[model samples]
Target: MRVKLIESRKVYDGEVSMRLERFSINGRTVDKEIVEHRPSVGIIAVEDDRIFLVSQYRRAADRALLEIPAGKIEEGETPVAAAKREMDEEIGYSGTLKPFLKWYLAPGYDTELMHLFVAKNLHRIPSRREMDDDEDIAVKKVRLDAAVKKCFSGEITDAKTIAAILAYRLKPI
Candidate 1:
């Protein structure tokens, strides 16, 4: 796809940013808005037969969600490093990370590329990284098979978590 930019303006700048733009594509022109987000990583931390999950309230969604440990890739950080960091901070454990999948969260109007990894051989740490001030995460554990079932039964609704669970089921690391 080819798009010629006519104008671009930043509309919001917080943890996530948004931009409004005008672009023309192949003789057609239109205005568009996009979310500018740093790349992020989600870790499917599986130890034994269980998968680690985190339950936290999402202010934007106004409800608690069950999800895998995840966070934005910081500046100058690789996806694998971000995955390890998120696992440590959120789950208080670290594991061997194997990249599983990568996809755009919303390509139509977003620049967020999500990297998913399956973490194995987990071991607890004496002290984990501190959580972000805005985050209040509760760790949860469920049978790996049951988690995959939840994905198909609507219990696991978070997109990244669902994708990671299914991907691990299909092609485990």
Candidate 2:
């Protein structure tokens, strides 16, 4: 399916107000407006039975929360590349990252599409995030089961984290 622009509306000339997704289905043209958004990447960093995670202060959550490594994809970056870069930057690890799952983080208001991945065959190195800007992350290594429990306990409420964990379980080793 490809978007064939039929008509466009300028909501705000200052910034990208919205994009009308125009496409054809069964010889009929359809249009759906979507907010312009950036793609994101997530990782379930795993080693043996343990999964690497991070604990950080989520301003929206009002406290420090546990979650798998994730971040937004920068301009002109692919999801697969973003996954590898995030794994290396956030957790100080690098290895084969298999594409796990892809979904919309929240479709109601935001157009954030997340690409979840499993970073297997990890190599532990010194953390590169020694002194980062506006980020204070505490690295944690938890058993996969424990991570799942924390997710259920609401200690980890991020959708990407939950999706990554579930994908890890369903995927073939």
Candidate 3:
């Protein structure tokens, strides 16, 4: 399949955008609208069998979410750098991060790719990174097993969190 972008403009500046595109497949062409989002990084930060997570209200979901540390990949920054930045900003910690997985968060209608990482040997930072003006995050440390259970029990519903937990369990750092 070959896809061409017809037009794109940020629907929500700095967050998401609407994209008009045309796809050619097997001599047939179809036009589709998509959500063009900046790629981001999500980290499964671990220390002594515990996972660092953050809880916050998600306006789009109309509910609070328990999720791993994550943020958009800033321009000219590598995925690992973004992971480190989010970890410090959200959890007030730093660690050694290794690539675990990469996947499209929502491929059918969104262009956001999430780079997942596993952060081990974490240490607390003297000062936490400032949260964004609109963000209020509560940090939580859950045992690895309990975090995994939360995923199966539907308590941890964030896509990146679920995927990262399972991935780390499969191949720990």
Candidate 4:
């Protein structure tokens, strides 16, 4: 089981997508194409027993989504730094953070990995939410139980949201 690169080259360089294809194999030969994405961060911002979420329209999904605060780690930025920045920009808060789990968003075809964090002992700050000029984002707060319920209700359709809440529920205090 190994990726044998027969041929590979960068396909595109854009704000959201950078794709590549490699000729590969497990037991047989196959051409595998993967998108090389910037690493991202997901924050489960906690204050007492509540979690922060952002609701916005997703052009890809064509519906409003309730998701954990998240963004890509820019060049030369650590995942923790990106998470802190996203938490403040999206929720207007910064806090002492507890490192949590990390996971790949979609391993089948993408190279996007996400670092998950729990931020607590919080304080308010002015938000600099310059979400893509086309974005329509609204911030909200919810109890962890309610947020988990929203996941079951499919009101929270984002992967990072579900992963963060489930990890919080499973971790021992």
Candidate with maximal lDDT: 1
- Model 4 per-residue lDDT tens digits across residues 26-102: 76667666888889988888878888899988889989889988889999999888887887778888988777887
Runs in model 3 deviating more than 4 A are 1-14
- What is the lDDT, from 0 to 100, of the residue 35 in candidate 3? 88
Q: Give me the runs in candidate 2 sitting further than 4 Å from their true place.
A: 1-35, 127-132
Candidate 2, 116-173: lDDT as tens digits = 8877888876756443464577878998888778778887787778777766766745
Cα lDDT tens digits for candidate 1, 1-173:
78799999999999889999999998798998899999999988888889999999998889888999999999999999999899989999988999888999889999999998889999998898989987999999999899988888888889888888887888887
For model 4, which pairs clash?
Answer: none
Where's the lowest-lDDT run of ten residues in candidate 4?
126-135
Best candidate, TM-score: 1
lDDT of 2 at 48: 86
Clashing pairs in 3: none
Sort by TM-score, best first: 1, 4, 3, 2
Worst 10 residues of 1 by lDDT: 164-173
Poorest lDDT segment (10 consecutive residues) of candidate 3: 5-14
Question: What total of clashing residue pairs does each candidate reach?
Answer: 0, 0, 0, 0
Q: TM-score each candidate.
A: 0.93, 0.76, 0.90, 0.91
The CA lDDT of each predicted structure is 0.90, 0.77, 0.87, 0.82
Give lDDT for model 2. 0.77
